[model samples]
Target chain A: MSTTNSRMSRKRFSEPLLGIGGILLFLLVWEAVPRLGLVSARFLPPASTVLVQLVNYLGQASFWGDVGQTMFSWALGLVISIVAAVVLGLMIGSSRFLGRATHSTIEFLRPIPSVALIPLAVLLFGIKMESSLLLVIYASFWQVLLQVLYGVQDVDPVADNTAKSYGLGRIARVRYVVWPTVLPYLMTGVRLASAVALILAITAELVIGSPGLGKQIGLTQSGGAVPEMYALIVATGVIGVLINVGVRIVERRVLTWHPSVRGEGIA
Target chain B: MSPLKRIAYFIGLPVLLIALWWLLTLGPTNFFVPKPLKLVETFWTVWASDRLWTDFLPSIIRLFIGLAASIVLGVVLGVLIGTYRWLRSFTEPILEFFRAVPPPVLVPLLMLLIGINDQMKIVVIITGAIWPVLLNTVEGVRAVDPVLSDTTLTYRITGLARLRYLVLPGASPQIMAGVRQCLSIGLILMVISEMFGSSSGLGYTIVLFQRGFAIPEMWSGIAVLGLIGIGLSFVFRGVEGRVLGWYHGLREMQRDT
Candidate 1:
């Protein structure tokens, strides 16, 4: 038993070590390619140089400002989309006729890639926060809406009928029977939307030249700041990783009562 | 459930929305919002010309190439990593980091390294679109039933035979999910790469129209992109239905029992 426990512990320890070793190997290769002059040092600077630039960015006020702009757009867009989608989803998803009437329209609109709206966004808003928000909202809204619609549809007919027999009002029935059923799906939607909103926010800034780290990266590239451009890209990657982790944590917490979450604990 | 009812349910909302747009834009108060009819006319004139071959065709070809490359690379690498425990551990963090990085963020760096050309655009799409396929494939491969694997081992199945009979089919559902994501990412990257420092493509032409203040033309371009997106999704559904038919049958059998 002790031997098995020790082996298990050792396995856990080595897992992350393997991951770290992989990253270290990657960094080493990156450092070598430029240092050994195999590739142009100007374009692909040594990994150390990019790391140093990333550290420098940490101390700069302008870097924080850019991060703040990106986050603000992301948060605002996500919030707006969630509010709009939840309300509309609930309304449309509750009625069979309404759901059918809108199914084809939603199908048509949902597949329209939000990036295709860049021209309209640029023309209407022109390198402003609204442009980023528009793209972010459009891209993420469908994600949440679809999930919410499915969730509402999944509400148990027996439970709903039980509530109706008990003289529960429409609002009361929704609060009691429907809300619990939909929470899990809504959580999934939020997780998907959060990542998509961040991507769209950055894309809008990168392509439309809005004020954010994406714009900063674009400026650095244009200005020939090779290391800085790499640094900003790394920053964006880190942000993406952190956002994913944060949403996952939130999903777990919010869905603790969900069977899927409970099933994980058991298995 | 009748045919007429289905038609009405599907078409009613869209017709109403278009009619509303037409009514609202009748006075021409907002210059940015073009009338639906005028936009359609501009779309025909703009795309029916040489731009169809010069811009739209190239973008489509690049999209297809990038998607094909991502599928081949992602599936091959995913299977190798998934089949070996050590490889899975070693590559997990690196894959996660790269996947998290918005594909758009890589555009500038790729532009610098590869120059603003067709090759660069294709590479951008591959980098962005590859992740979904690769990650999903890895998960799918890993989820192959242990009992089934043991059975294959008992039969001494190995290499090409094993992969063809077990591994590929087991991982295909997840692979299809990845491919679905890959399609959208490829489309987005194709447009985005063209937007940056390129002379001709769908994205470039749209930007050009916007900059030139050709409002109707720009709207038309966006409409074309939407049509393409819808068309691709239909093609994907057709492919998915055929590919996953056996899996669905198995699922139905399980539910029945």
Candidate 2:
């Protein structure tokens, strides 16, 4: 047991180092390919050059503005969708009639790719932040709404009945019983929605010519600023990594009492 | 629980919503929100003709090609990496980085590198759609029952036989989930790619209509896209049912107890 524990600890410690080594090896290849003229440096810039451009972007106020714009739309759209989904999911999921009534309609509408709404968004809002918001909300809304509905359906019937038998009102029962059951599912929804929201946010800007990192990427590509384009793409990747990490951290913190999180460290 | 009640509940909301839309846009004053009847008429006129062959077919073909490529590449690489612990650890960060980058961002990059062509569009789809399947396959492979693997080892199972009989079946459910995600992501990337510089696909035609103020026609394009989305999902469900039928049966049997 002691040997196995030590071996597990050793493996865990080396894994991150292996990951860093992999990244470094990738960077080395990225640097070598262009430097060797295997592919023109004009198209695929050396990693050093892109990194320099990324550093330059960090110093620029306009770059921050673009990041701010993209993040703002992502956050606002995600919040709106979560709020709407939670309220509606609770309402629909609690009542069998409402759930049945909306089932077909939801199924019909849910599969519609949100990017297909870009034309409508452009027509209504015309490349403004609202256009991005529309796409983001449309895309992320279904992800959370479905999860919330499932979460509501997952409420323990025995506990709910017990609450009722103890003279709990509808509101009280919902507050104490429904909310806890839904919290973990809701967190999962948020994590999923956050990724979708960012994707739509970037996509809207890329297609609609809105103000964001995606647009910056487009402009750089169009203007033949290859390194800058690569830099911006790298920046978006970093943001994506950060958002994922942030969501995981928040999920752990918010769901500490949940069995999934509680039993995690023991394994 | 009655069939009549079930039918009503299923179709009632959609019918009522369509009726509400028809009533709300009854007049000829609102150009943006075309009447439901007008949209149906426009849908038939625009999509029921040769544009179906030229625009719709090509978009679908590109989507499928991209999806097929992604599935093949992702599954092959994912299985290889998943089979080996050292390889899995070494590639984890790189895969995560690639997956994190929104696939749409690849559109401009690919357009520049590969030029504005069908190849670029397909590559865009593959690049973005590949991640979900690859990542999910990795997780799925890792989750395969250790006891089963030990049994295979004891029986001297190896190579193609082991992969076919054990690894593939074990990872299939997760692989299906990834493919489901890949389908949607591929569709999105398809539209985004065509929207960029292409002139002959479904997305381009829709943007053109929107640009020319062919409001009803653009709405028709969107409607067709939605129908395609619905159709793809239905087909996916059929395929998944076949692939995961045993898994589902097992789950149900477990639940029965």
Candidate 3:
């Protein structure tokens, strides 16, 4: 038993170490290729150079401004969508009638890729922060709303009826019965939507030329700051990594009492 | 839930919204906000124009080619990763990092590397589309029935034959789901890549119209994109249904029992 426990502990510790080793090996290969003159270091700047530039950018206020603007749009859009989706999702999801009424509209609106609506957004609100907000809110709304609808549909009919029979009011039944069932789905939807919100926020910046890291990337790339461009790209990627990890952590915490969370990813 | 009532309810909201839009925009507004009727006319004119044929085909083709390439790459790479335990653990962080990088953000780098040609656009699409399929394929491969693999092993079956008969079929349903997701992402990247310095595709045309201040035409362009999106997904669903009919049958049967 002791030996088995130690083996398990060692295996657990080694997994992330293995991941780190892989990234290190990747960096080494990246560093070696440019140094070997196989590929021009100009186009694919050495990983070391990119890292140095990234460190330099960390000291710049402009970099933080870009990061802050991107995060602000992401957070604002996500919050708006979550609020909109939850309220509308709850209202629409509460009845078979409401769901059916909105079926055609939702189906039509859902597949209209938010990016494709860029020109429309630009038309309504030019290349501004509001454009990013529009795209982000539109895209993320569908992601969460659909999940919430599914959550509502998944509520046990018997439990709901029992709550009603126990003289619980609409708000109480929602609090005790509906919220528990919907919470898990909400968390999952939120986790998925958070990534999407960030994507749209950056895409809006990149395509619409709104202010953010994406705009900075385009500016640097065109202005002959290749390493800085790559560094900015890496910064976006790091933000992406942090967001994914953050979402997953928040999800686990929120859904700690849920069996599904405990049983995630069998292999 | 009468059929007539259901039909009325289903169509009512959208129709009302459209009417409201047409009504609200009846008076003159900004040049950008054209009446729906005018926009529809513009859309009709644009669709009938020769550029629609020229621009639409390449974008659609890029979407398919990139999606197909990614599906192939993903399934192949995913199977290898799933089968090899050590490699899976080692590659997880790299994959996760790459996955987080928004697909559009890679466009500039790809454009520099490949030039702003169809090839560049296609490569961007592949980069964007690959992650979903690859991750799904890995998950699917891992979820392949243990009994099937054990049986293959016990029978001394190995390599290609085992993969074909056991792993592929078991993982196919998931692979199809991944393919569906890849289609959407592929379309997105196709537009985004074209939004770069490239001059030929729907994205280019839309941006051109907007910058040129062809507001009605620009509106039409966006409408057409939405049509294409809806059309493609509907087609994809039809194909998914056909391909995964057996899997669906098995699931339904299991549910019954």
Candidate 4:
């Protein structure tokens, strides 16, 4: 038993170490390619140069301010979308009549790419954070709303009927039965929306020159500071990965009772 | 509610929205929110001048060329990776890294390297569109039933024959989904590439109008693009439904069981 426990511990530790090692190998190759001048250093700078530039940029106060603004807009947009989608989804999902009535309209509007409305958003909101938030909300609301609808649909009909037979009111039935089932889907929606919200926020900044990481990258690129541009692009990539990882952690914590996670023993 | 009443309720909301928009802009304090009536006028103005068609055609041409190239390349590479375990393992990380990098971020670098031209726009669109299809194709192929694969092998099917007869059919549903996703993404990238640095296309027209503070004309340009987006998406959905009717029937069977 002691030997088996030790073996499990060793395997657990080595799994993450192997992943880190693979990542390091990739960075090593990236660094070496420019050093060897296989590609023009001007176009694709060494990883070391990008790291140094990233550190330099991080030291600036404006960098933090821009980051804060971007995060603020993203959070605001996501909150608004989550609230609106959940409420609307509940109303629609609870009523077959309503859902059928609105399905066609939803189908019509859902496929229209939110980014295509940047011009309209810019005109309406004048390149402010409002514009960015509006675009993000537009992009993310449908996804969450659909997931919530599906979640509500997936609720056990027998459980709902049992609650109804117990003389529970509509609200109570939803609280006891519907909400729990939908929570996992809501979490999934939020996870998916985080990536999308980030993309829209950055795209909004890029197109309209709103103050964010995207604008910084665009400025650096046009100014011919290729290394700094690459560094900022890498920073954005890191931010995306970090958000994904953070969301996954939250999802695991919140969804501990979910069959998919519990059955898989993912903690 | 009855079906007709339900239809009315849905249509009523959008009608109300349009009415409110028109009412709010009736005596607009700002030019940015042009009255809906004036927007119609601006649309006709552009339409009569033949500018819309001239600008729209080039954009459409670029969109199709980019989409076709990406679909071909993505399917070929996705198949190679999906079929071969070693290739999949080798390329997975690199693909993930590139997928995380936003396509618009690559526009400037691509422009600098390849020059600001139609080629650059097409390349950006292709890069943007290819990832979704490639990833989806890989997933689709991976999800194929092992039993069916073995059965095909037992029948002496191998290589291209196996792929054509077994893998491709099984993966068609997901591939179609990927294609639908790519179509819209390709359209957006087409516009963005043009807006950022190009002399032609609807994006350039909108940017020009916006910069000049031609609010009515800008709104008109935006409206045209929105209509195009709606039209293309509808067409793609029609094609998808036709192609995936068999899959839908299978799904119904599974659900019934």
Q: What TM-scores do the predictions have? A: 0.98, 0.98, 0.95, 0.88
Identify the CAPRI category of the predicted complex in candidate 2: high
Better of 1 and 3 by DockQ: 1
Order of models, best lDDT first: 1, 2, 3, 4
Which residue pairs in candidate 4 have backbone atoms (N, alpha carbon, C) closer than 3 angstroms, thus clashing?
none
Instruction: Give candidate 2's chain B TM-score.
Output: 0.98
A74: Cα error in model 2, Å: 0.7
Off by over 4 Å in 3: A264-267, B1-6, B253-257
Q: Model 4: how far is A147 from its true place, Å? A: 2.1
lDDT of 1 at A118: 94
Q: What is the DockQ of candidate 3?
A: 0.76
Tell me the lDDT of model 3 at B127: 93
Clashing pairs in 3: none
Model 1: per-residue Cα lDDT at residue B237: 93
**Cα distance off (Å), candidate 1, residue B145:** 1.9
RMSD of each: 1.3, 1.1, 2.0, 3.6
